[model samples]
Target: MSLFPTYKRFPLTIVSGSGTTVIDNKGKEYLDFVSGIGVCNLGHRPPHVQKALEEQLHNVWHVSNLYQIPIQNEAAELLTSTTNLDYVFFCNSGAEANEAAIKLARKHTFKEKILTFKQSFHGRTFATMSASGQEKVHQGFGTLLPTFEYLPYNDTKAVQDVQDDQVAAIMVEVIQGEGGVIQGNKEFMEAIEQKCRELGALFIIDEVQTGIGRTGKAFAYQHFGLDPDIITSAKGLGSGFPVGAMIGKEKLAETFSAGTHGSTFGGNPLASAAIKATLEVIFKPDFLQSVMEKGYFFQELLNEKIGSLSVVKEIRGHGLMTGIAIHTEALPVIDELRDHHLLAVPAGPFVVRLLPPLNVSYQEMKRAVEILAEVLDQITDKTINSD
Candidate 1:
């Protein structure tokens, strides 16, 4: 059978990756700045992640949740302790985590209304896509889940105007990854938290793309001093392996009773092993400090090189999940970077996103910046020549 033609794939097919570089089938090397859409936090095929998966292969791989899984317990312990949350539920992907969070919120509050913000990308599942504020993704997906409302992002009063006891939860992204790397305002987030409290509604933070060490902190919510009632994470949790988790306060988590929700592959031994190793490496003081330092260094380099370009409008985002908004469509820049043997992704129509591996070296970052500078110059020269 032919493979499904869903993705608009890049010209090259990557065969292997190590650290921040990937080699295509033709043996051409490219610096990976997108980090598999921010899933490869520790970079591609880190020794720790590889070793954990290797060791688990020698033992057991799949054991249903019907029985005890020690690795799952270890991962849960680490996640809860690191984030200071009380309970956790493991799933296979970010979409499932968000799905579980949605169900839990509604069940616990016995309310049907969920308030989300504009330009937010949650996940691709039926309910998650419905919850997502991006109309492009929701297009063609039939009638969405009911009682969901969309409001302008960063508007506290808009949220306050609709909040009520019937609201089950307010879901948000601390940093909107697929929505052009826009960071949420601190005041707006705090106000939403306060409103949720006042209305007895849960506040769910979808950190699927910004969690782990991507934001120079364990979780992006920590930066704003706002604690979410429930937090969902996935992309960086397993450092490439598929894993997702929904963590919450002890009382709030109780709503999920036996048979409430489950996944066959969630928290499997292999994925859990990867998650355990990823957390161990990322939670280290030195590693996290390096992430912060590198983020500043990269942003400085970008500002120095392309910040003043006529087509470059703004540079936004924190830590490694950065985006550069250009006056022109970003696809041309993305393609130019590929020609220069650097890989990146477009976050939106005018934003070129950079989500290099958290462990990306200073040297690699410098090389990427140089290449981007060259590409920008070429684009500017071409535009001038045409004019």
Candidate 2:
């Protein structure tokens, strides 16, 4: 193979996609519940994002950050205007955004330590991988960058007991997407914010997998009435067009002055066009409300179909991001789903993660759940036969 074996890719090869369906190279169609691991929140090749990208292609694809780029300004304005943040630094992926947030937190507070929760995922870059709390991600890295402490998720007392004075920030995801689709406790989440205030540390929300209306809000943090000092966004920010942003409050604006940080392709015209268009669509009140309704309907369908199955453990999530925690390994279930012409992914060893398009139709959800029910039924039958 010419490329490095970084990903153990799925067996099927998808050639084209539209809306909630993807067609493989052999022309078989599947309901795409994975949504590119929550990156394609608006569905594949969404028309609004497509139009904006085409227009930008006619104008300009790239320009140096040194020059004035009006499209970048428009994209940044959309993010700042929608949230409590004042400034935005655009980048190319979630890892870059988190890296920028880390740099800003340390520079702004003059501190070295950061606190993240165990079972959390940040990204694959050196700094972001260090920020991630999962040890498996750090294995063989040979002495990762220090000063990061991993706390237990949803533990209010652990955050309350933080006594380190050199902590620069406490970074967390509202929903631990890669950590088995785990939701953060309201009391625990608030305590992190409060503890940051108590310790003079920046409150950072890593919205890489949950931002841009993924959870029926402009950002998932909005659901909890929490105002984060630094919000790192990617994944669905550009509707799968590869863009990330680091948003911060007004007070720390001067910390990242010129020559401090930048990306060559960050906020270029094409990326800016995609980000602006995607945000315009997802930020709409009606659209986000529809996502909420669909999520409720989807989860209800799953419960109605397979919630009681011996192999099924629980169904949980927020908005279009849902998970089915099964009693068995998630990979086998996911493979069976794919074989039945449906697609989902795994959040961990036991949680089957589902991230359908926000605009996925009701019928599509029903079909997905039916396929899931069938898959679980087969597993149940096999167990019964063996017993």
Top candidate when judged by TM-score against the true structure: 2
Each prediction's whole-model lDDT (CA):
0.91, 0.93
* Worst window of 10 by summed lDDT in candidate 1: 156-165
Q: Tell how far residue 37 is off in model 1, in angstroms.
A: 0.3
Clashing residue pairs for model 1:
none
Q: Please give the lDDT score for candidate 2.
A: 0.93
Best by lDDT: 2
List, residue by residue over 1-387, the lDDT tens digit for candidate 2: 799999989999999999999999999999999999999998999999999999889988898999999989999999988799999999999999999999999999999899999999999999889989998899998999898889999999999999988999999999999998999978999999999999999999999999988889889999999989999999999988989999999999899999988899999999999999999999889999999899888878888999999988888889888989988899988999999999999999999999999999999998888899999999989988989
The segments of candidate 2 whose C-alpha lies over 4 angstroms from its true place after superposition are none
Clashes of 1: 0
Instruction: Report residue 62 deviation for candidate 1 (angstroms).
Output: 0.3
Q: For residues 1-387, could you state the per-residue lDDT of candidate 1 as single tens digits?
A: 397986778787899999999999988999999888999998899999999999999999999999999999999998998775898899989999999999999999999999998899888888899899999998886898877888899897887677467889999999988889999898899989988999999989999999998989999999998878899999999989999999999997568888988989999999899999999999887998899999999999999998987778899999888999887889989998998999999998999999999999999999999999899878777777888
Worst 10 residues of 2 by lDDT: 294-303
